[model samples]
Target: MATRIDLTLDCADARPLAAFWKTALGYVDEPPPAPFATREEWAAHFDPPEDDPDAADPAGGGAWLCDPDGVGPRLSILRVPEPKRAKNRLHMDIRVPGHGGPAERWERIGAESRRLVAAGGRVVTEFEGHHVVMADPEGNEFCVAAAPA
Candidate 1:
């Protein structure tokens, strides 16, 4: 069997970051485990200590997202006390779907970039006819590139 993996991001806040990623990646909030009606219900089962630094926020804690098509790894955004201090060693490359000439591919990349910008992402740099380096609302870097041909 193939090994499955989940991608995790540590952030000062998870809800807004997760919201931005959902729009950027076309992902949805992962449903609670079976038999649990909601995420809160599942969390209540743990009853973590109030002093536990890793505990989920009672106001609506960490956010989990999954690709709607079930093709991508699950995303787990956990809350952390410290802020991000440096660039990410690894980042996501969001490929725009298309098999076309440079001009057409650039157009597709530009469109996707614009959509992500509307979803709270900002362009860091653009390599015309190639890709655009972008940062999410929380300043995590990602790229918008043309799908491989």
Candidate 2:
């Protein structure tokens, strides 16, 4: 039988990234999330529909943000206790150039990355090969891998 699952990405600030990816991908975060002033207030009202107080806060589970109308996969930016270890275990690879190659797209992405850095994102590394690895403000490593040169 086939099964479906939500994709979870780990990050330190799920709140901001939720908004970022929303604009970046044309996806939408499900509404502003039912508000609560404190965790205890949240805990009392945010339980799942299954009816269990010992259960988790289903609405705010793991930093979730979703694709608009389920066009793409839902991105769940789960929080992690430690910083990112090495390269991405599952980085997003975008094939740019459409026809030009990695080298060709370098300048374009380079400028974009520069703006991103100026805006506070840090370039973990930019490779001559075909990829540029970067950390967002909250420090998640997603990459912009170009087409082969």
Candidate 3:
């Protein structure tokens, strides 16, 4: 059997970036941990005292998203102190299946690219064979590729 895997992204801010990914990938926020009914309640658990920076940002920490139908791997985005200074060593390639032919596949890829751009992702560049390199709002690079037949 194939091993199941989860994905992680390191970024400066987790919430907004995770939100962007959520929209881009049609994923939903993973529910708050057990014993907490909602995200607000979970966040309230870490509410900082007065005069604390955490009071503004909250210490609840990070963001996780998962495929709603449980078909795809989970995605975890964690907060990091430093900015990304170089290209990613590993990156995701968003795969859009080829529907009928090369033309249809390219069209679908274009449509999805536009949707991602509308959701605060930018197409950094395009490449051969229906591939478009894109960057999230935080400038993390990934690609949207037309899946092979």
Q: Which candidate's TM-score is highest?
A: 1
lDDT of 2 by residue, 1-149 (tens): 75666777766656676665554446665444458654435546644556543355443434556666775667777655566666666666534453565456777677656665665567888786556787777776777655555
TM-score of each: 0.91, 0.60, 0.82
1-149: candidate 1 lDDT, tens digit per residue:
99999999988889999999999889999998899988878877886878876665552458989999999999999887788899999999999986989999999999999999999999999998899999998899999998889
Could you give candidate 3's per-residue lDDT for residues 29-147 as a string of tens digits? 99988999876678778746686544555433578899999999999887766789988888888989866888788888888899999999998998755799999999999999887
Mark the regions of model 1 whose C-alpha exceeds 4 Å error after superposition.
Answer: 53-56
Q: How accurate locally is residue 41 in candidate 1, as Cα lDDT from 0 to 100?
A: 80
Q: What is the lDDT of residue 76 in candidate 3?
A: 88
Model 2 misses residue 60 by how many Å? 4.1
What's the CA error at residue 66 for candidate 1, in Å? 0.9
* lDDT (Cα atoms) of all candidates against the true structure: 0.89, 0.61, 0.84
Query: Which residue pairs clash within candidate 1?
Result: none
Model 1 C-alpha lDDT versus the unseen true structure:
0.89
Residue 140 Cα positional deviation in candidate 2, in Å, after optimal superposition: 2.0
lDDT of 3 at 97: 88
Clashing pairs in 2: none
